[model samples]
Every structure is written in C-alpha cells, then in structure tokens.
Target: MTGGAMDVLPAAPAAAAAEPEADEEADPPAAAALTLSPADSPPAPQVSEPRAPDSSRMQMPPGNPLLLSLTLQELLARDAVQVELIPEKKGLFLKHVEYEVSSQRFKSCVYRRYNDFVVFHEMLLQKFPYRMVPALPPKRMLGADREFIEARRRALKRFINLVARHPPFSEDVVLKLFLSFSGPDVQNKLKESAQCVGDEFMNCKLAARAKDFLPADIQTQFAISRELIRNIYNSFHKLRDRAERMVSRAIDNAADLLVFGKELSALGSDTTPLPSWATLNSSTWGSLKQALKGLSVEFALLADKAAQQGKQEENDVVEKLNLFLDLLQSYKDLCERHEKGVLHKHQRALHKYSLMKRQMTSAAAQNREPECVEQLESRIVEENVIQTMELRNYFSLYCLHQETQLVHVYLPLTSHILRAFVSSQIQGHKEMSKVWNDLQPKLQCLFAGPHGAPSPPRSPQDGLSPH
Candidate 1:
C-alpha cells in the first residue's frame, strides 16, 4: 500500500464535473434529498436482483492497507515492551519498542519528540472531529526527569492504543504514515496529508450548518453549565470580599481596646476617682493591655492567613469550573466540525448519484455511447459506497456525542457540590462567631478580682483615641 492513500478521491474539476445537461430533459421531478438525521426512522434495507458474478471485472485497489484483514483487538494486542527517553543535542526524544503477539511477524521501534506528538494529536483532532481523541499529557516546562518521562511514556502508549482501537481513526492515512515511516519522510507526509484534510474540511458547506445539527438538549445543558459557573464564581468572589472586611473590622476593634487600656493605666494613683465599673489595678490594667495587643496581632495574622487561603481555594475552584466549561465548548466545536465534514461528503455523493442516474437513463434512451454509460454506472456505484461510509461515520459521531452527554452531566453536579461545600464552611464560621460571643464576658470575668471594680463594657469607639 502506498503511503498517503486517501479514502476518497479528490473532487473533480467544477467545469468538467459530470452533471445531467439540464436542457437534455426537464430536471427529473425534484425528489426529496436523502435525510441523514440520526433520530429519523431507519430506511428499509434495499433488496437487489440476483446477478451472476463477473470475473472479467477488474479488482478495485484498496484505499487503505491498515484496513486489510486486521481486527481492532488484534492490533491492540501489540504492547509497548520498552520505553526510553533519549537526550539529543537539540532536545529529548521518546523512543519505544512495540511487540506484536507474534514477535517474528511484527516487531518495530518508534521515536517521537514531544512536539511531534502535539502536532499529531492536533491533526487527529482536526481530521476526526467527532472521534474522542485522547488528550495528550499536560505540558511540562522542565526537562524530562525519570518519573515524568515514564508517566508520559505510559500516557503516549495509551493514546496509541486508543487510536488503534478506533476503526475509522486507526485507518487514517496520517496515523499509518507516522507509525510506519521514519525521519523526514514521515514528517513531510503527515504535514501534507494534514493540510489536505484541513483544506477539504474548510471548504465543506456542512461546516456552516454543523451547529444547527446539534441536539437541543446538549445546547441547553451547555447554557445551564455556563450560567451556573458564572454565578458561582461571582458569589464566591463576593463572599471572599465580605469575609475580609469583617476580619479587618475585628482587627481594628482589637487595636482600639489595647489603646483604651493604656490610657486607663496612665491615669495613675493620684487621679480623680475613676467610675467603679472602670477602675482596675495599674499592674492588672497593664497586663490586660499587653494581652489585648498580643491577641490583636495574632488575630490579624490569622485573618491574613485565612484570607489568603480562602482566596486561593476560591480561585482554584473557579478555575476548574471554567476549565470544565471550556472543555464542553471545545467538544461541541469539534463535533460541529466532524458533522460538517461527514454531511458535506454525504451530500456531495448524493448529488453525484442523482446526476449519474439521470444521465444514465437519458443515455440509454438516446442509444448513446456505452462507454459513457458504463462510466456513469461506475460512478453511481462509487458514490453509493462513499455515501454509505459517510452515513456510518455520521451515526457513529452521533452515538459518541450521546455518550459524552452522560459524562457532561457530572459538571453541573460537581458545581452544586462545590457550592454546598462553600456554604457549609461559611455557616461553620458563623457558628464559631456565636460561640465566641457567648464566651467573651465569662472569659473577662475570670480575670477580675472579687473587690476589683467591674470592667466597663467595651465599645468599638472606646479604645481608638490617639495617645
């Protein structure tokens, strides 16, 4: 099999394109175009008249060699026997040995740098938008250590296995070329094929209509998640701000109490009689002032620490939620692209089939050239095959999307759990405050002597006077 074997032939030139000459006959009364909607009732299988096999007909060449007699399970039986990170002057390369069940029949080694994998994954995503392309490992800035390389090696193997298991994706020309070719040839072929696929996808009319084909329920779910995430982020932000303000006020009050205690101590023994509720021994007052200052400083430090931690935690949650939303959006976009490509191809095939059928009927009536009629018949067969494949690809994508929705349900549930957790923590803080308030007076009384005057009730304004 030649490298870069395309599954579908390139589109014929527009001018030379085969179309029933409209003037030849009134356009065969316009029949309804085939509807490829996944939700629609399945069409009854067509039964064709039995015919003798024609041995004289030439055998068609296979489009892709990887599709030849290889089951997905058989391909996946190949294992990564050894993985190594080889350091080169330019950078690092990941090398691995693949051993098939029959070692003698199939054993090979492959090498790919990190960037190569990244490029390959991107191309795969573009080419097969509906397929669940396994995610690459997160990017690491630092050079590969043993653990990092080992983890990446395992991830890469899993990714390869996933690709191999997917029938349509496994037969992708780029993937086959990448695995079998080496050096510059692999890179060149992969790049060329990627560009071709990309260009074809871009030109597809279905791309424009892809969003319309999305299930309404999925769209609604996405909208709900987006709104929920936004609300949670804003609510948490506001809660963080209010908590900080309350902590700030408490610290200010503590400082004021410390200052008022210092003033009372400065009044001295010769001072005019202090209010019975306000009088205390100077030594006692001094100790109280020091304790207040210490407690105030400690509370301030704790508040700062708590505020930092709370903010950090809130940021992390919001980030994760946003990431989930982003992932959903990305998946939808990929689905749209996949649907567009498949639908576009299917439509084109339908168009060709219609044209050929009309042209063949007209040619037969006019006793026209047999060669032209044969060509038209051949095209009809080819278009039918292409249309069948496209339909299969379309339905597969639809099924995949439906399965993915099950996974998407978790996003909103996770958000709800996180929101409840935050609320519970806030409630816990409120309960702690109530407990502290109930204990404050009892704690103060423990420090008072039996003959000593009771301390005046502290007010927010009491201790804030400047020296």
Candidate 2:
C-alpha cells in the first residue's frame, strides 16, 4: 500500500491535461464551451460509473510494505473510501492529521473499521488529557434535537429490555427512567409493573390483619405476618414514588399502618420477668419452698425425685429464654451497624440525585428548552442513584428484623413457648401436692392399716417403667 501510494500525488495534472484534448475538434459551440463527448474521451476505457481517481492524489512514504499492500488493495476494491490520520506523539502536531490514508490504501486497512475507531478513541483518551496537543476546530454542538430524541428513545427501550432480564434490579429504576422520558409507551410499561407490586403489598396487608386475631402467646405466627406486612410496605413506597398511581393510595394507607404500628408496638425489652400476679398461692408456695429444700425426712423416698423433676423443668425454660434474648440483642446490634452504612450511602446518592434534579429543572425552563435527549439521559443517571439509595434503605430494615433467618418470628415465638411451659409446670405441681403430709399417712392406713404389712409386688410386666 505504501509503495503504490508514493506513485500517486495530490498535485498530479492528469485530470486537467486530459480535459482540453478530449474537448478539441468538437462541434463549434460544444468545442468553444469545453464539453467533451464519447469519441473524444480518453482511450483507457469508460463505463457508466466514474473511474477510480489517479494514484497521484494519494501520498505515501517510501519502503513501508504494509502500507504499500494497503494502498494496492484499495486500488482494486470498489466502493467505500478509507481515510486514516495518525497524529504525532508528544509533539507540536500531536492532534493534527499527520498521516493521510485515502481510498487508494484503505481496502487493506489493518483494523476492522469499528475496532479501528475504538483504538483511536483509547489513544485519544490517554494522550489528550496530559498533552497540549492541537485539536480539531470546534463546530456546532449537537444539532437536530429531534433526531437525538428519536435515537435516545430507542436506546432507552433497549436498556429497559436488558434490565428486565435481570432479577435483582428494582422496578423503581425502570419507572423513573420512563417518567423522566415522559413518553407514552414507556409510561404504560412502568404503570403495569407498579400495579403488580401494588397488588402484592395489599395481599400482605390483608394477611397481616388476619393474623391479629391469633392468641398473643402464639408470637411466631404473628411475627411472620408482621414481617410480611413490613416488606410489602417498603415495596409500596418505592413503587409509589415511581408513579404507580393505580394502587398508590391503597399501598400508601397500608404502609402507614405497617410503619406506625411497628413503631407503636415495638417491644420495650427483648426480655421480661414472669408477671407479678402470676405468683403461686401461699399454700402452694409453702410446698414449693419445702420442695426446694431437702424433703428427705418427711417424704424421704420421693424427695430427690420431686426436686430433680421440678428443678429440671425450671432450668430448661430459663435457659431457652435467655438464649433467645441473647440472639435478639446480637441481631439488633448488627442491624444498627448496617443501618449506619445504609445512611452513609443514602446521603451520597441523594446529594448527587438532587444535583441532577436541579440541573433538569433549570434545563427544562430555558428559552430553547433543553433537548429531550440530554434531559432523559441525565434523568437515567440520576434515577439510578435514587433507586440505589432506596434499595439500601429497604435492605437496612430487612436486616433490622434479621428477616433472612426469620428471627423476628423466632424470638417472639420462643417467648410464648417459654410462658406456656412455665404455666404448665406450676399447674401440674399444684395438682400433685395438694394433699397434706399427714393426710397421705391417713390415706395409707385407711386403705389397709397403719401397722399392716406391705403387699407383695406383682411381676415386672404389671407396672410401668419410670423412663
């Protein structure tokens, strides 16, 4: 391409020289006017299409085979001229067009056209920043706002389609993009998604209400319902903010209840002692205290059995409740730490988002009105930041309840279970020890005689084993 490029010069006079002779001896008027005809044209041969330009127009350096090959290939190829301009590195003409490659050498261009542009782009990005290189003269900035709008609309549609394919993305981002565009089609799609989320939120609210009828001691079931309600409430806000008006009011109302209810019903403490009014009666308390002491002399044989069984039940319930409370506290601490992180990220995102909103508002009211392309583009970026912040907020609450492991459900439920066990132990002991110590001896004597001999035991199969 290089060797052949040198033979062609931009100053070559063939085009001019061929014109006059070709026009001579023509009819008087035609000849005087400098028009040429078929017979008088050059003999190299002519077809309907224009001939390739003379090689002299293309300039090239000597002895570069690669460049030569490129030039020769271009000569034989038809259609689509190639132009290359290589700028100098770290020099006065760094950004100027130093190497001009025309159609004559383009057919054998080394890089694929698209890849070629990228290569140049990367070079420009690196070099143009640090060097005082010459740059092309400026022209008008972004003419034809409508053309750009059409282009942006297509681009945004494609982007939304791509994002929809990913599960993790929040729909709030999608709707914000649509709202910013204010295009009918985009708005319709956003509205549809909002409706779906709105429905889910409503269903969660209904389920939560139903759970309120359950007994207070059944804490786990209620906790599950409440957590569900809270999740839906968070989703409702995110969707509502994005313009999901169909169910917006409903979701908003539900959210109000869920949020405020949680705040109002918030546990004073993760733990509490047994209620004071639940204390045992005086007679039962007396027996309980005696049981606590060594009862070997009065009820000698049954002393260890009663004490061990009663103490075991008390120890089991206390141990389980303590473990549950400890876990609840740990989870709360972790949630607080996470909330701090969310708050920090939210601050940064909101700052950027507000700046974008201000820019858009200013741009919208201008005399010419900023192009929809730029407005939508800026909104796309800003909306991303907003949605990210919102998601962070949702995640903070999600962690707050430790919903991933269902701890909110587990903690309260464990408390209820412990209460039931404690009540059962107190009631059972009261029933079994109601008789006085002397009454037991009287009963035994009535059955046989106070001095009567004991009855012989039956075969082992006649009685149940303790275990």
Candidate 3:
C-alpha cells in the first residue's frame, strides 16, 4: 500500500483536476469582464441620479473685497449673532440687566443697557445718512418689568439683525467695532470713526455723481410715489382728527338730549288739571320726546364708539403710511448714494480712456513717439475694462438692492395699508347694519300704544286725532 501511494497518479485524472482549478481562476476574470461589459451585464437598476445644484441658489459673489468683505448671507446668518439679557443684582442702589450683543466672528461680547441700544440706533441713523436704520423699541420708564424687558429683548434682536443685514450700514467699520467691543474706550473710538466715515461719504465726489446714475423716469416714479404716500398719509390724518371731533360732539349731544328727556318726563308727571285732549296731547308729546331721547342716546353712543374706533384705525393707517414713506425715502437715498459711487468711478474711467485715446491719436499723427502711443493705447484698454466693470456693478447694485426694496418693503406695505383700509370700511358697514337692527324694534314701539292703536282718540272733541 505504501509503495502504491508513492507511485504517481494517472496523468489524465491529475490533468483533469488541474484544468478545473485553472478554469475556476479564469472564471473570476471572466465574471469581472462580463460585469464591466454593457452588452453582457443586465441593465443597471435605473438609479435616479441626483440633480445638479442650482446656481441661482448660490450666495451673491464676492465682488471688490475692499468694498464688502461679507456676503448678505454671511452678514445675515442666523447663528452669527446672539443677544442675551443678563440680570445683575448689585447693592440697594444698583440693580440692572445688561444687553449683551455677542458676535461669533469677533468672538466678543458687547455689554450695554437698553439706553445704549437707543443711542446706537440714533447714531446709526446719523452716521449712515441714506440708510434706513431699524427703529428701537420704545423705552419704558419703569425698569425691570420682566414681560416688558422680554418683549424688548425680542425686538432688539430683530433690530440688530436688520442693521447687520444692511450692506452699506453693516460695512461701516465703526458699527462693526461698536458691536464687537465693550466699555467707554470703544464707544469713543466708534464715535470718532463714525464721524469720519460720515464726513468722508458726504464730502466725496462719489456722492455728487450718484444723481446722474438714476434715470429721469425712475426719479419721476419715486417722486410720484412719495407724493401719493404723503397725500394718503395726510388724508388719513385728517380723517382721524375729524373722527375724534365727531365722537366728542356726539358724546356732548347725547348728554344734552338725556337732560331734555328728563325735563319732559317731569313736565308730563305734573298733576295740574287740564282739558282731556290737552292732557292726551301733553302725555303723547312727553312719551314721544322720551322715545326720541332714548333713540338719540342709543344712536349717539353707537356713533361715539364707531367714531372712536374709526379714529384709532385711521391713526394707525396714517402712522403706518408715514413710516412706509420714510422707509421708501431712505431706500431711494441709499440707491442714489450707491449709484453715485459706482457712476463716479465709471465716468472717471471713461474720461481717462478718452483723454488717452486723444493723446494716442496725436502721437500717431506726429509719427514721432510710437512708444508713447503704445503706452497710451495700453492705458486706454485698462480704462475701458475698468469702465465696463464699473457699469456692470452699478446696474447689478441697483437691481439687487433697489428692486428688492421695492418688492419687499414698498409693495408689501402698500398692500397692507390697502387691505387695512378695506377691512375698516367693511367693519363700518357691519357695525351700521347692527345699529339699524338694534334700533328697529324701539323705533316701531315709539309710534304704537300698548294696544298698537293711538292711545284711544281723546273724546273726539279736538280736531286732531291721537294718531
């Protein structure tokens, strides 16, 4: 048996086993090739490929870094800023809550009181002459009212967010510094910086050029819109004033009517003897007077309430319209400023190019100073490129900022005012209907006695029927 094991196996069986092993190794490569081959492989389960990202969703491109360091998205990022109110208890003389404005970018917290926000809002308005700074919440004389403070805290947060989102206002170095720094030192620094920026912006040649960028048609539109808003505001204000006066008069008239009704009642009760018809007439007149007084009093009360409500609504509409007008004006001013800067630069480039072209033409004509002509041509090309870029930027800024303001602020505010006005009219109609409904039974009862007949014709002696 050992000798037989040592002997070699049959060649055919050994060859057959070796061939199977080789075929197995080759199967892996064959399978891989088949998997890669489209014709041999089964249809790939249709996968819904992810759609390409929409370029429109991308944030505004960073244009001239010197002009703006942050995109609107970055500036308006919800997580970039946090405002918290920290309550502190001091000795009996000093207990206060501090408004902390924390900037994620600067990793700094600015501690301020409510008064500081008021000052900051004022400063913002003064510093950025054409920008619409958000209004601060009204100040409360009673400090440390928890609900009031909490409400104020929310408003302040929105106020800060609005300021930060405004491009020109947000880019102001002083504003950013104020938000990032604490203490009086920073305040003084910010004030000085703010004055410098304001002065520079106002006095610069750019400001002068801004008006040229706005077309005459656009200016006309703005003027027309402003006038319309002003007229509307004035009309509403007048209406409110008239309503208040009417309410006052109605209340006074109601009091006088009430007194007259009482006097008639007393006269009717007098027991002095009189003719039967005369007594009937006296009683009828007294009853009629009392009914008239009751109806007058009811109507006067309703009128007073309606007038008061109308006046309040009118006041609100007037105030809202006024605020909208102010915002519109601010938006116009900001657009003008931005356009001036861009247009001034564009015009400068154009002027430079023209001057260089003239110089190049003169040099070429002289046939003496080809090199100078070449230099002038190069400079002209540079100027042209700059001019083109500036023109593009001007259009982009106008469309992006001004158009957005019209859509977001102007249209929405106008629509809200119109809707409110319509609603007020509808409510007035409803209230008038209610008053008529309420007075219907009383009016019907005024003419009829308990038996629904003229109080039995008084002995038919008098020519006048009780009816």
Candidate 4:
C-alpha cells in the first residue's frame, strides 16, 4: 500500500449497480472478440532457436586433464610439473632395446671404448627425431665426380692386378656374352651399369651370358658366377633395409623412451663422424699413455684406501703387485741370459742386437715412473754396452785362441749376472719390506688393551710377507 505505483492505476470502474440480461448462447459477446497482432501472439510461441556452441569456452572433467591440458612447450617452461609417472608398458621400446642388444656388432662395438662413438652416434641419430632432417647434399664435390668412381676402379684394378696383373674385366666369357647380346650397344650398357656398386648389370644371369668375355685368369680368380656376387649384394641390401625400418620405429618414440636416438641418425653422414680411436694418430698414443697413468694413480689410491680400511683388501693389493713384480723380474732375467748366450755367437750378433734393441725400446715406452724409468734406461744402456764389448772380447778370444785376455770376457758376463742378482733382491725387498713396517704400528694400536693396558706381544714374523 505504501508503494506509489499501486495507487497510480485508476480504480477499476465501479461495477454497474444493475446488471443486463445476457443471451445464454452468447456468453457476453465471447469475451469482447479478443485479437492479437503478430508481435503480440504470445511472443510468437517463443520457438527457442537452437543456440550456437560457445567458441571461447573450455571445460575439463573431474580427475582428468586430457580435455584441457597445457601445450608441451608450456609444460616444459613450468617451474615444476609434478607428474605421477607409471612404469612403461611393454612394446616398441622394449622391442628396440632387445634388437639393439642382440645385434652382434652392437654388442661387440657399441659398448667398447674405441667403437662406442660410432655405434652410439649412429644409434642415437637413428632412434631420435633428428633423423627427420633431410640429407643436404654437399654444395661442392669433395673430389671430381668421376674421381671417386675412378678411384674405386683403380683400387679394384690394383687388387685384380695383384692377383696376376691379368685383365679381370675383358675376359672371353664376357666377350661371348656380348656376342650373344647381338650388339655393342648392350655391351656398352652393361659396362656403364657395372660401375655402379649395386647395379643389376652385375647380376649372375648377365655374368653367365658374358662368361665368354672373361679371361681364364679372371675366371680362375673369381671362381663363381656373377649370381653369387649379386646374391651377396642383395643380402646386404636386405640387411640395410631392415635396419632402416628398425631405426624409424626407434626414432618415433625416443623422447619418452630415452633410447638416445639422436646419436643413431649420424651414421655415414658428414656432421656426425667417427671418433679419434677409429683412426690412427700419434696424439692418440699420448692420450693412451695419459689414460694409463690416470688408471695407475687411481688404482694406487684405491690400494692405499683399502689398506687403511680392510686387512683382506690390503693383502690382496700387495699380493697382486708382488706377482707383477715377480713376473717382470723373470722377464728381465730371461732376456739378460739370452743376450749373453747370443753374444757368444758373434756371427749372429747383429741380428740379435736389433731384436734386443726393440725389446728395450718397448720396455722404455711402457715404464712410466720417473725413478724406475731412468733406472731401467740406464740398465738397458749398460747391458747394450756390455753385450757389445763382450762380442768384441769373444771375437778376439775366438781369433787369438788365448786364455790371457779371456778374463775380460768372463768379467763382463759376471757383471751382468751380478746386476741381475742385485735387481732381483732389490725388487723382492720392495715387494715385502713395507708389509711389516706398516702393520707393526697398526697392530700396536689394535693391541693396546682396553683402559690403556700394555700391548700384547706379536710374533716377529707376523705380517712380514707381502701376502
């Protein structure tokens, strides 16, 4: 009642006090003949037009982000994307791993030091998306176009020539095959295709027909039909085809599988090439020596650590070193004795001296320790001089047949023997001397009784031997 709009409507005209009679059939003019305009026809029955789907809206179902996940690039840039990773189900990843491991070349070469670079590089490239990069041919030929082909021809020719300097290509069987062809054009065509490594012209059927063109010498060397060569080539081709298929499959899924595909795609390409170990170089020798030195140092430290920690390990290292030292001493003794015996045979001294020099050079190259290397070199020089002088002395003894100067011959021989004996004793002492020296103090510490009681006595021989 307080609202003003309620009172604004004029009060419905007061109902007339007298009512007029209405015809029963006419119901008050049928409610005054109501009519509706097009706009007023109950709002045109409100035929709800189908709505267009919302273009800018997105929705995700509960517990699943599949419908509304971020793009891979966005995921990568996130500071932390905690994903509940499940173990891989068996399929292509496992299959490729098995294939790779089962391949003999992969097993022997892929995991080793020298061949690993090639195997791994090739395998990674084959297994990764990097393989999608198309081969971009070299802009400039490394050699003349025909140069490579001619080089191959020359190499094959050289091999055939070495077989007997016979013409391997222009033999009687080949001539007969050409004659059978009924024209020189076919022969020229065959020659053209033969230059290609895997061309079908080199097939056995063609070779059989051309057998008359081959010389007897060539036939004797090859000893087989062109078919054999073709089959061999085809077999290799099949192998390569299979490998390519495997490589494609491996690459397709490498991202999630961690199969290292990028390395595989580099096979036979300019970008990814062979490693240093695959080729020879003087620098590689230096690297090898450095690696060996590092390994030696590492082993030495390991031995020292083991010595400080465990009695068994300490003994094991000492025993192995002792064995190695003993073997070296034996080799030195054998070579020294052999040199002396060879010197007595002056007629053969020159040849024997060369052999001894090679052995000495090898020993020098192998010896790495500063003191030991110098000592060994000095010893080798001394032995070489002794051997030389003895040769001369024995020659004089032989020519003069005199005992007066024979003592010179015997003296040098005796010096070598004495040196060998002293070296042996010194090496033996080096191997065993520290065993007790180090153990005595450690034993004293271990034996000091609880509450600082006096240490117990140990046998004098305890820990004296290296092993």
Best prediction by lDDT: 3
lDDT tens readout by residue for model 4, 170-220:
222222222233342543433432232321112212211222222233222
> lDDT: which is higher, 1 or 3?
3
Tens-digit per-residue lDDT, 1-467, candidate 1: 11232111111001101223242122221112225344222233221222223322223235422113333235435332333455544325643322211111125455666666677787787666555565666657366566676656655655665554444555566666556555654555677776633421232333323334444344334334334433543554465455445444544554554455444434422335446776656557654554453344334433444454344444444333433433333343444443445445655666665565677678889998676677756865665455454544434334343324322333353555367547645754664465456546544642655465666566767679685
Estimate the TM-score of every prediction: 0.41, 0.24, 0.41, 0.14
Candidate 2 global lDDT: 0.33
Candidate no. 4 TM-score = 0.14
Clash tally, candidates in order: 0, 10, 1, 37
lDDT of 3 at 220: 36
In order, the Cα lDDT scores of the candidates are 0.45, 0.33, 0.49, 0.28
Give the 10-residue window scoring lowest on summed lDDT in candidate 4.
96-105
Kindly list the per-residue Cα lDDT of model 3 for residues 1-467, writing each as its tens digit. 12222112110000011133244223211111111233222222221222233322213334321122333344345335667888765657766667889876567788877777766776776655434555667776456578787757766776675666565555566567768766676656656655534332332233323334433344334334334433443454565456446445545654664565456455545556667768756666666665665665555545555665456554445445544443434443444444444344545554564565667668779887457577756764565455343433333333322333322423345556667767765776677678768877766545667555644334445667565
Worst 10 contiguous positions by lDDT, candidate 1: 8-17
| Positional deviation of residue 421's Cα in model 3 after best superposition, in angstroms | 3.6
Task: Give the Å error, residue 457, model 3.
Answer: 17
- Is candidate 1 or 4 superior in lDDT? 1
**Model 2 lDDT tens row, 1-467:** 23343222111001111123344223121111111234322222112122233322223224431111232123223222333334433446332212222322123222112222233223322311111111111212235254443333332222222222211121233323322333434434444433323221121212112222222332243234334433433443343233223223333443453444343333322234445675534333333343333322333323333444344443344333433333333333333333344445655566565666566567767755556887677666555555544443332332222222323223343445457556655754564365234435533322332234534435777677676
